[model samples]
Target: MTVLLTVLAGLGLGLSLIVAIGAQNAFVLRQGLRGEHVGLVVAVCAATDVTLIFAGTAGVGVVLERAPVVVDVVRWAGAAFLAGYAVLAARRALHPGALRAGTEGARVPAARVLTAVLALSWLNPHVYLDTVLLLGSVAGSHGGDRWWFALGAALGSITWFTLLGVGARWLRPFFARPAAWRLLDAGVAVVMATLAVLLVLRPV
Candidate 1:
């Protein structure tokens, strides 16, 4: 029962941190909506989260916490990437005719999608802060049960990404319209831009 509670705590905290609107989640949603390489994208995200969580649990967090420069570098790179993606999204939103619903759009290369998702996953400093530092700190509080907490966090990440990628298909009908694509892109643009700015201004 004690182990279960620790796991639950980790799971809940993991979900709370990851479920928010962010560059990674936004990109995942867009990929899911396009029905293109959703599995690959989801796998990359979940795997990255699991890897980071475990790394943190393994005491990597202590090393990273002491080196603020590493976080700053990631922050700047993430900001640049987000800003560029936001521009692309804004352009897409402006040209609704170029947009297509479901699998109707021009096929993007899987390699390109892979690169984008990886950039989003690895470049974001917030991931290091939340998944590494915060989660690691909390897991340490559990003492010998820290691994259980890490496992639960990993499970939360796997569950969330699987549901997000697989469940996005249900919204295909709604996204069938050009207007919906525009709205979605517009939202993505705004979100990406906002996050980019925040990443630039916010200290970790």
Candidate 2:
């Protein structure tokens, strides 16, 4: 029961952190809506999350906690990255050309999508904090069942990405309209801006 409880806690916390509106989730949703390279995108993201989670479990989390400077640096970098994405999203929301540029977005190359997936996953420092550091520390608090906690976190990532990627097809009709893209980009901008501000102002 103790092991089960630890895993459940990790899963819950992992979903809470990951499911929040952010750049990664926004990218996933876009790829899903496009229906191009969706499987590859989902696989890469889930794999990256699993890698970071285990790295955290193995001791990186402790190292991060000990080095307050490192966390501060990451916090600022993540804030900047998120804020930049917000600007791009806002631009897309306001520009008709930008929204219509990739109307047949299905033709986008797999390599291009993969490159973006990697950039969004690795370039964002938030992943390191949430997946490696935060999850690691919490898992360690579970004592001997830390591995189970990590596993649960991995599962949460897999499940969330799979659902987000596969289930996005259902909204295809809505996204078929230019107005939908405008609304989506606007929402993405707000979410990104909020997260960036929170990152900068939050106590490390």
Candidate 3:
């Protein structure tokens, strides 16, 4: 059916957008390895993304698209956040021993985890441009059953984050090694810094 094809297309597109080693995914993996509230973090990330995708599909993204100034503000803010996060990640990478000797069994508060996930998910302009404008545009092409397209996109978010969390958990043994953790922290730093530079250099 045409509807089925559209939904599949949306799913594919959504997955492609999210299946990257970016700040969000790196943070989720780090928290998961730390034995933190992995489920809550993944759920919050997925749920927040789904909400934004729905808003975009409902034509809210069009209104946002019309306001260039608002988009500019979000862009600059996201850039700044990414830069700050990059600094923290770089610091961690440079001093992995400090984190290694700390309370590995320590639990982060649910509220803090939720807040971090929400900020990572919602504060990025790429989130809006990808989920809202881009995905919404694709979904809008589905005519009468656009909601199905949105559902498929939402499903993509849920599937990806769930898999990431579970997969990271399975890799806990590998991450337990000090060298491995150091490499991961360094990778996170590089990814975040790259994203931050890209965001800053992006054409407004």
Candidate 4:
């Protein structure tokens, strides 16, 4: 019973950490609405979480604690990437591309979609701080139950991304119009830019 509670506790904590608006989540929503490359994006997010959770559980978080420079590198890189994506989103807003649903109109190349998600996953310092260091510390403190905690956290990632990626289709009607796409892009642009500025000013 104690173990079950611990796992549930980990699950709740993991969901809390992840259920925020961010670059990765925003991109997932966009792809989900567009009905393109949603599966790959979800898989990338979940897999990245799995790797980080396991690494954190195995005590790699301690190594990260000692190496502040690595965090800084990711910080700057993430900011740059976020800024770049923001620019792209702003451009899309200005142009207002058609939001075709379910394999229609024109398709964004699969490689491009995958690359964007990968960059969003790896380059974000917050991901490392939250998933690797914070979660790792929490799991480690759980001692013997650390693996179960890690598993719960990993499940949180899988569940959230899967639902987010799939559930975004519910917004398909709103996104079907060019005006709606423009508004969405404009919002994404703002979000990415704001996050980039925040990253520069205060990393992690």
lDDT of each: 0.89, 0.85, 0.81, 0.88
TM-score per candidate: 0.96, 0.85, 0.92, 0.94
User: Worst ten-residue run, lDDT, model 3?
Assistant: 97-106
- Give the local distance difference test score of model 4: 0.88
Model number with the top TM-score: 1
**What lDDT score is found at residue 13 in candidate 1?**
92
Expressed as tens digits, the lDDT of each residue in 65-107 for candidate 1 is 7888998999999999999999988888887555542236578
- Model 4 alpha-carbon miss at residue 105, Å: 4.7
Residue 40 error for model 3, in Å?
A: 1.5
* Residue lDDT tens for model 4, 1-204: 878878887788899999999999999988898788899999999999889988988989889889999989989998999999999888877763422332246688899899999999999988988888889999999999998898888989999999999999998987767788888888999999999999999866
Off-target runs (Cα >4 Å) in candidate 4 are 97-105
Off by over 4 Å in 1: 100-103
Model 3 lDDT tens row, 100-134: 54326357678977876777887788888889898
| Top candidate, metric lDDT | 1
Per-residue accuracy of model 2 over 1-204 as CA lDDT, tens digit each: 888887888889889989977778888998899788899999999999999999999998777778878767767877777788789888889988877765453477889878777867875667888998899888888888999999999999999999999999999999989999899989989988987898888845
Note the clash tally of each candidate: 0, 0, 0, 0
